[model samples]
Target: STVLLTGANGFIAATILRKLLERGHTVVGTVRSESKATFLREQFKAAVDSDKLKFAVVDDITAPGAFDEVLRAYQFDAVLHTSSPFRYNITDIDEELLQPAIQGTTGILDSVNRVAPSVKRVVVTSSFASVVNRTKGTWPGKVYTEADWNPTTREEGLKDVGSGYYASKTLAEQAAWDFVKEKNPRFTLTTLCPPMVYGPPEQEVPSMVKLNVSNLDIYDIFNGASDPRYGVWVWIDVRDLAEAHVLAWCDAAIAANQRYIVSQGNFSPQMFVDYIWKHYPERAAAKGINKHSPGKYYSDEGIYGVDTSKSVKDLGMKYTPIEDMLRDTLKRFEDLEAEGK
Candidate 1:
């Protein structure tokens, strides 16, 4: 089957691109620039030459008919939409976050609806931010599941950094569901809501300073720049998350307008620090990694846990433990540092 992977160079989409290739699927990846398309071609040179991989350029996803030409060009079996604005620090919430997040999603869906007749499934990378209500803390023993939706409005997103991001994700995902409800396209939709995707990055990391948002805490902790402040303390490995996307794409039973909560379990920065101190003592000592007292860092109020039963049953999601996620993330940092990157 042929797959169209949007945002092919992103931290998570890169893994999805590779996984689809490994599964013997021909993939057409979309990037914002020629440079990113070149990077993908070089990264998967063998696949490209064998005619199993290709790329396209869609610079601005919010533009009308952004994906129309590409959708018309190929009979894609699945369209994995992973492109979204995810900056934490923002000046213009509407332009920077909401417009790209909301319009970008709708534009692609509209294209897929109108042009791509062969596309069977469309897997979107929604975030846990769209599911968890940060303001109204979760009750005890109340594990968040796919049924929950983040209650953030566009007005709330205009208030602050956190609300803006939450709102972007919420509105973007809501738009997707609404499109499916109204348009009733031939392709089924599946949304994966994973929190704080942390693990060894598949994409090139030029420097430790340029680590992705999810793995920044590991970098900060190793360099002694962080205390054990556990914020939104849950995660899923990038690799695992990518596989879940693939599962959602291939499995017709699981692809029917399902929203998956793709989390492994609870985690914290202190846990990473402890693992490094105990397992890689020499490096921990060299970096002067400090383990703050447990009382110092704690989970945010109202944030509790996530349930992955649906993912496990529907997508066959076998989670990678947080300890391994921490160790491997640090090892990637070490590998990059050794090469002086």
Candidate 2:
């Protein structure tokens, strides 16, 4: 069965794509340019040459029925809609986050509705932002779950807490459900919600290993040292996330129409860093990074604990500890830089 993965080149989605390939699933992925086909081919040689992978350029997702033509030819069995604007900092929330997040989703759904009736399952990538309420402002608690929607997450509201990015996801997902309700669509919908996805490099994608989301605690994991949060806190591994998705695909008992918080155990980056530092002290000191720090650098206020029991017991998700993720992430980057050196 062919899987249609939008945002084929995205950081997180690529992990899903790699996992799909490993599972012997045909993947029809989207890229922004015809020129990228060669690069994708090179990167996905195993899948592409196996006659199980194909690529198409979806230059602008905002175009009405953007994916109809592609799906017209191939009957995709599943759709992994992972293309959403993800940026830590943004000034114009409307233009940067809302437009792409909303239109891109609706536009793809519009196409999917028209073309691929064969698609049975559609997994959309959402975020913890959509689940937990505004923390920087007013947070009810430090724990959240799939049952709760972010407090300010009105889905259809002016830029309040979510600004535009979160608004977009909340709205777009709402729209998807609404659309499904109206049409009684053939496909089942599930959303994968990840909170500060932290883990080691399962593959060579730079985004997978690099701490791209934060410098000084971007919702989870502190900077400079391993925080006590690592001992009791919760964090999601990208691998675990991928595993949960795969399990969702297979598990029939689980609710097909629902969201899952895809994370494992929470540990501080310091424990992970120190673990690696112990093994590679020379590597650490050479990098000129401050190796010593203390206290609860990773805080519940910074990163509220999330319950993934549903995703775990239902989808059978086993998350990777933060320590291994930290060491592996650092090692991967260190190796990458060394390659150039």
**Per-model TM-score on C-alpha atoms:** 0.94, 0.82
Candidate 2 C-alpha lDDT tens digits along 93-139: 76667777778876777677777888788887877767756544423
What lDDT tens digits, residue by residue, belong to model 1 across residues 242-339? 99988997864755899999999877667777787887888777877775653333445534789889888877889998878777887887888898
lDDT of 1 at 306: 91
Cα error of candidate 2 at position 241, Å: 1.4
How accurate locally, in lDDT, is each candidate?
0.85, 0.66
Output the lDDT of residue 68, model 2: 86
* Deviation in Å, model 2, residue 87 alpha carbon: 1.8
* Model 2 quality (TM-score): 0.82
